[model samples]
Target: MAHLSLSWANVAIVLSLCLGSISYGYDFSIISTTVGQPTWYAYMGLTTDPTQASLYSYSNSIIGTIFGLFSAGAIFGGLFVGWFSDAHGRKKSLLSAAVINIVGGALQAGSVHVGMFIVARFITGFAAAMLVALVPVYIAEVAPPAIRGLLVGQHGAFFLVGYTVAAWVAVGSFYSANASFNWRFPLSLQALWPLLLCFFVYWLPESPRWLVSKGRPDEAWKILAKLHYDPKDPEQLFAREEFFQITSQCAADKASYGDVSLLHLFTKPHLRKRTLVATLVMWASPANGAIVIYSNIVVLVAGLGFDSADSLLLSAGWITLACVGNFANAFYLDKLGRVRSMVIGYVGCIVFVIIEAAIVAEYGGTTNKAALSAGVAMLFGFITFYGGFVDTTIYVYCSEIFPTHVRAKGMGWSIAVFFLGNLPFLESSTTGYATIGWKYYLLFIILPALNVGLLIYFCPETKGLSLEEINGIFEDKVAVRLTNLTEEERRDLDSRILDGVVGKDPQAQAPERNNVEKSAEVTLDE
Candidate 1:
């Protein structure tokens, strides 16, 4: 991996953006917990209980609409973010997501009818997906290569936190004395992260890469210095090298792709490959049983004969386990590398989901405590492992691959695919469990099984490279092996690149692809 100092400037940015991620979680997932509550039943006029104290059986379509519409809106939000973030700028796009989130959150809290609630779900989904999709792009831009996964994956970790909050809020709403306050308060909680984002919007530094692409190298340089600063080195060697690399590569990118278009993703062969990688990764994002567990586990546990209250609480614990897994992902993600971790996550999901389906098939609707206990235990274990391997894998991997020119758009399109992917799971869950029972999970087994093959073929390892350097991988060009170089070697290489005209200018044409990869291969193995 490339060497860059992990400094306080970078840490602060990670912490701040975590709030946006948590907010994204609230809307992305809270629907699961929200719809489970009795107050929600009464509030939506599904139950006649005036005090909003009883739950009722809403048809599959209604429940599906609640979950499906949010994702439907999320698909639009993720697609819009590409143009919105690029045309308006990162900071403004973030603010736009926050403000819109607030409107959706507020309306959800005040919704008087199911129609109003459904509309709010769509509106809320739009902003939440926007926030989650863009946070990785911003974080990846500012992060040092050494700890890039740790920072970029924060949204996934804290997103689990938001989901955990939803679980707890659902538990609390179940017991609240006031009916309206119970569901209303929990629904309104979706605004917390966005509200904090609105308050702190001024504090966000613009993405340095976004700045450079928009023709402001000076600002990008300062942001890089502040983020990757090293007090011990007065020369700011690593930081300076990064600036040169970013500006040089971005210039090359501009020269190559004039006026980047969304169509370029499919039309240009190089970008088409990159697009295929991102789409495949994201298309599989909602593929496995992970989303099924997130959205419908409480219902599953309830089927195991745990009453509504205990079911919600256990679901909360399950989300907490997922959060722990996300933390674990940050610690070792770069070490395992994205492709391996992703494969492991998918394969692991296959094993545990198979066990869970069998358990649900045999023990569901029964008071067989021991079998139910085993079933629940397997489900929880599956989530923890799933979280560790997959939570941030798709977003971090996809965001890191694209050049600055279409990064936002690529991510937007990628995230949109993710939400669109959710439609299948949500739509199926609505009717599958009621009709096929455990067989629905059997359908999930196939996608991840297929994805393992797709991932190994389409994705390349990008563990230790700057965003600028990542360009070479897709183009079959190896620009630089900055990670394997020692400090003095890097300084010397930096000097060589600076005295440009004597050789192939690093700014104009990158070094030949095969030579650098062959050399770096030996160093990487060691």
Candidate 2:
């Protein structure tokens, strides 16, 4: 029942890294508002119907292209970071991505034509992808295992804040009435978050796990000391034990795998399973139509016969509720196992979206106020479940699944798959919403149901274990060395190898032992 207590330094790391996710959220959600604006349509010359002056009036193709291209750029950006972070380091990759976003944001705000704007959006998408890919990896590496889920859950919480702010900003922008400043000003705010990140991120500590992977254990040890050692603990027991595990594991992994290539992620049986599970986890998290729902929410609400002002307000409320859901996720993510929490989120989304679809099918464009209210409520419920149950767990699962040797690359592959996964959902939204209407949500419902099944079988529960000890889930019960140990030696080795200075909980130890036994049995059968 007790939550992990954080030191001030721990608070600073979580705040800094998690805050970086806000930029992506703001830029990503800001488009929802901008594209809904009449001024945005006019500025882009897509307002063909002057009679529909208050609406976007752009064709499905145009809307699809604008949204789809961002995913395309994100796919590219995600792949690039895998190699870049592994080659350089986590801190440098983040700073570089922030710089790229600044350039892209400037271009977006100052654009004179639609072509110019599209290119700028792609650049920004590219930059934002890097932040999404690397930030979770940084968080997972930096946080203590006891509280890792809570720390990583902050990524989703901060992301919802960005989405909420953008929705309200769009509501405020609507009052301006002037075509030029209305859309341009909101576009310009995208630059502010990355700029703040650039200034402060460089000064924070790099991931000690990453440093150890690069054969710089001395520097890694110093950082681990700073991060984990409390002067109040006279023995320095926890920090020393943790440091030893990290160094020992790095040595063991190097010996086992030799030099790591990305190919090893697929070539080794256990590593391949980790890679697949991690990538699939990323794909499933967003499968519940989060991007589709949020991106086109204003248009969907308007299509339900609400006025532009009311639609914007309604979308803002829906997103605000989602923000609250994410905060709840941050609090209880550690208490609920990752597999259970994610299942709850996915199932919640499926139920809500099905209800929304039914209501919209029955009552859309009608004067049935009750049906309209229910539909709006259903959409809000969808986001609430999506943000809390699904979105919150994606990064935490993906980041924790990989060892340090392949951590960044592993994260990149998963995120790249994430963006690529978005392509089908995002591309379908504009045309699907314009044509099939509420039935469009059926797609979101079906895919996530399948994902839930996939997770139930493959995803391991990763609560309350150190990063080093987590490898036991994948490693052999016996070490891979040529020498054999006596029964007494084996028990001592198991205690040291499986549990560190902090004694293991029976609850955690039981599942972990099962995981190791199951993995070894499976390998033997193979």
Compute the lDDT for candidate 2.
0.78
lDDT by residue (391-434, candidate 1, tens digit) is 87777899889888799999998988888888978977856786
Local lDDT at 139 for model 1 = 91
Best by TM-score: 1
TM-scores of the candidates are: 0.91, 0.88
> Least lDDT summed over 10 consecutive residues: which range in candidate 2?
476-485
Per-residue lDDT tens digits for candidate 2, residues 56-156, read 33555667777888888898998899889989999999999999988888888899988888888899889888998888889888787778888888887
TM-score of 1: 0.91
RMSD of each: 6.6, 7.2
Please, what's the RMSD in Å of model 1? 6.6
What is the Å distance of residue 494 in model 1 from its true position?
3.3
Poorest 10 consecutive residues of model 1 by lDDT?
501-510
